[model samples]
Target: MKIEILGTGCAKCKKTKEAIEKVLKQTGVEAEVIKVEDIEKIMSYGVMITPAVVIDGDVKLAGKVPDEKDIRKWIAK
Candidate 1:
């Protein structure tokens, strides 16, 4: 699985990445986690908000940090 976190390197963005990493470690889900900080690249996903999450090329959430519950659901295979 591929997980991409799109943001401009803000606090929320960092938290999102950390949260995802924690969940992945706890769940033992192996995935290619990427941080997309470029504006153009983030825009490519059609995400206008910072701190967005894209899983397997599909936009899952945007605007705010996701809680552990949402992160687990998104990362579940």
Candidate 2:
């Protein structure tokens, strides 16, 4: 699965990325996590807020860092 964390390296963005990584490790899931810092790319996803989570090219979460369990559930789906 392709997981994209969209932000300009803010604290929330980092937290979101780390949470996702921890979940991936705990679940033993092989997924690609990327940080999207490019403004154009982020805007193209229609994410006006930072710390957005995109799974498989679809926007799943945006604006804030969601709970790890929720993130894992989203990834699982």
Candidate 3:
């Protein structure tokens, strides 16, 4: 799975990245986690907020850090 975290490297963005890593480790699923810091790239996703989670190029969550439980559900899908 390809998990992309889109942000401008803020605290929330970092937390999102870490959360994704934790989920991957717990699920034992191989995933490519990327940090999309470029404005153009993030805009392409049509996300006006930072700290967004994009799974397989699909925006999953945006604007804030989602709970770990919610993240697990997203990854499971």
> Which portions of model 2 show Cα errors greater than 4 Å?
none
Q: Quote the positional error of residue 61 for candidate 3 in Å.
A: 0.7
Error of 3 at 1 (Å): 0.7
RMSD list, candidates in order: 0.7, 0.8, 0.9
Please, what are the lDDT tens digits per residue for candidate 2 over residues 1-77?
A: 99999999999999999999999999999999999999999999999998899999989989999798798788784
- Give the per-residue lDDT digits (tens) of candidate 1, residues 1-77: 99999999999999999999999999999999999989999999889888999999999999999899998898776
**lDDT per model vs. reference:** 0.93, 0.93, 0.89
- For candidate 3, the TM-score is 0.93
- 1 versus 2: better lDDT goes to: 1
Error of 1 at 76 (Å): 1.5
User: How would the candidate models be sorted by lDDT, starting from the highest?
Assistant: 1, 2, 3
- Candidate 3 Cα errors over 4 Å, as ranges: none
In lDDT terms, which candidate is top? 1
lDDT of 1 at 5: 95
- Give each model a TM-score: 0.96, 0.96, 0.93
Model 2 local distance difference test score: 0.93
Scored by lDDT, model 1 comes in at 0.93
